[model samples]
Target: MAPEQGTGSRSGCGGKGRGRGKHLPGACWDTLWGDHSPPHFPSGQVVKLELLEQVQAQLRDVLDKAMEEAAQSYLQPHRKDPPTQHPSPPHSSGLLEVEHFRTFYHIFIAMLCVFILSTVAVDVINQGSLDLDFDLFIFAFGCLPTVLATWLVMFLYTLLVPYKALQLWAGSYHTVRFPRLFTAILLEALLACHAAVLGYYPIYTVIQHQLPAASRFIVILKQVSFLMKSHSFLLEAVPGIIHAKPPDGEMKLPALSTYLYFLFSPATDQLPSPRTPYVRWKYVAQNFAKFLGCLFYSYFILECLCIPVFTNMSKQPFSIKTLVLSIFNATLPGTFLLLLSFFAFLQCWLNAFAEMLRFADRTFYKDWWNSTSFATYYRTWNVVVHDWLCYYVYQDLFWLFRGRSRVAAMLSVFIMSAIVHEYVITLCFGFFYPVNCSPSLPSSEVSAGIQVCLYCQEWYAQIHCPLEQKTFWGLVTPRSWSCRS
Candidate 1:
């Protein structure tokens, strides 16, 4: 909420930290002076704005130290503790604490600085002007009015609809004449409304407006995240309300602050780590510093290497050898971008927020690069999201069938993750090609069914509704590229 650092994806606008979020592309800037002065009391006196900034910075620092993350673990496979009757969220650091890894990072930072100097020298000599080209950033994050409007619409729906509905249900379920029937009807109606507004509204907005690259991502990802958070909140609250009926005045609702915090937290489920206390300024510094390195690394690699190779390939005659060489040339940039993206968004930036938010579990990534098998790689690649999926989807489905159908549970998890990813990709890119998103699960029928459904959807998109307004299905394919992809 402070003016210095950007809040989470909840409020995308008013970020003073320009290069902050991966999804939020810093489309809007915060005001020079905040609306409130920290030193002023509620009295009507209008205070000077000079000391306001310094006081806010100090207050923010103190709060960052005092704030602690939620105490819940969504995934602890080996834990022996018995499950509680109440259905609360039962889950789930830093960049580098290891000595050698920190040293490697330090060396990497030195090399990045050298590249930055080289770029400066090149710009000075070649352009004869040092003015930066923020236009590309502007273009990527273009359509600001639409982006903010779309965000406001989604945030308001998520904030009000689910929370209030659940609160109302909690209070009235005991008083209703036919509680079970009433509960079922209320739940069905709520779900139908969620499907309409959260699901279709963003799709309509994106298709109608044809939002720019970053704007589309912000809208799409924010919608997806809000859905997850709302689901988690309700999932945790519903069972407790059902099984444990107390006196009217003794009834408890999830605190509004906790729900809001969970919505803004980096991960889907609540994050809990008790060992670390206040986050040091250096740790926060390390996060942003590494983030800047990623930006510089990406910029230099694209401008110096990837762009040239692609341009040269385009001009040259097409051939098998050229294709092979082009692919070979692309391998470096492709690999670099993938790795840098993992470090930049997940490790650096997300952890920066975790630190500031007093979240202690810093296991953003694992030794995924060293993974020997596909299963291992998939599990380790993004531990936070995978853990969340395992806890919520896999565990629930596994128990839903009394643990007899592990395959069914795993397939459900895969299908659910694919659906969300595919939906985001579908609208953002304005095309549908999810051949690889739905992978084979050996049961064959599940994957086959999903693939068939996707095939039908793709054809529907290509025929009835052309998102790009023009399409060549059989002859030529519409090209869809995204920075997020």
Candidate 2:
């Protein structure tokens, strides 16, 4: 009886093994349930398995945290902190700080006072009484009414046309079969009309009438700037509207307040909702005072440093000697002009308007002076415009090219920027002279390298050489030239 039972158990075990082998390899089946020593995991294997589980859990936690952080960062591109009155402590401040400019502020104030005293003294010395020449400054802003009127027309077109066009396009885009094509055509037509009325006509009037330098500057700069701003608004906003899932029924336009804020904001990129700070009249007053001070500083530099040197050079015969001398003489005023223009526009003027309108983002510029490279300088110089070009122009090109042609994308941005700069210079000066042609040239990389080298040389010369030596070498000698040919 015992033998019979054992045979039956053996048969049952064999039958189960056969069935397992049909599904899995014999080695795999044996590994799962073969005859062997009692199953025992090594201590090392137990520790390793435990460690791997812990590692997986840790990885999951890290990934979750990273995703949350990424989402938060994506939602808030701009800093949300409100503006503060106090300058950050030096030790705590980041690489760039407004507090760093305190010493320079004192120096500029002293310099301005000295200029005022010198102007009075010079007038007394020359004419036996104080007789200030504010005519030049007055002349610079002579076409205020014309500028305002022209700006009004530009504002109306930009405010009304683009927003409405976008709304119409967005409403019809999904329902209509050939919506994109039709929308594109309509947009092009609107842009063409804008270009003709605001861009071309203003440029024509400036050139044909042979407007004064200052008047032409106001007209052309504003025209070009407004056109760029309007184009940016449409370019940024329309694509978003088109791509977005439509709400239940009716199409909606962005708030009028948002559009109005965009027009006046220092930033070129249009925001659906912008930060609005509390308007402080005192801050506004202070900013305006600084703006006027900057204007005076510019006028002083032009009158004292630039006028005498350039006027004297103009009278001299055109020779290597004169040209070299002029280049050297221009260095101080050129550097000063660069600094003044940056401060006046990026800080004082922008801040004044921002304060008046209670606009929160006051970072119109960065610490461009500290930049060691031309690329860095260009990026940091005017952040408002840089943001627009980077997002709208450069990034768009990169996207169009599927991220493969980075060099080509960068070159396109450079060319576009150079063209705009050249346009401003040529149209403002009423000449076809391409002042920024080198940077805009086909071989722009070589041109950029040359500029960088020239900049480095000038920087080294300024630092290593004493003021007296620099003046003697740069201002007096015919051979010691610094200007790019």
User: Which runs of model 2 end up more than 4 angstroms from their true locations?
Assistant: 1-99, 175-177, 244-251, 271-277, 432-485
Q: Model 2 over residues 140-259: C-alpha lDDT tens digits?
A: 777667666766777787778777777777777877878769877987988787878787777776766656667877777777677777788777667566667756544456677777
lDDT of 1 at 228: 76
Clashes of 1: 10
lDDT of each: 0.65, 0.64
TM-score of each: 0.67, 0.69
Looking at model 1, residue 44 earns an lDDT score of 28
| Model 1 Cα lDDT, one tens digit per residue, 1-485 | 44435553224344353222222222222332244333423332223322443565577677666553221333435546544332211122434656877887787678667767777788899999674674546666789899889889888888889988998899889888999998899899888988888888888888788887568988998888788788777887887788765774466788887777677667777545543345556767988987877876877766665655554444443456754565556555555566677888888888777767766665666777676655676687788789888877788899999989999888888788778776776666556576556334412333333343333334333443334444465323422211111
RMSD of each predicted structure: 24.2, 13.5
CA deviation > 4 Å runs, candidate 1 = 1-92, 121-131, 248-250, 270-276, 279-282, 311-323, 433-485
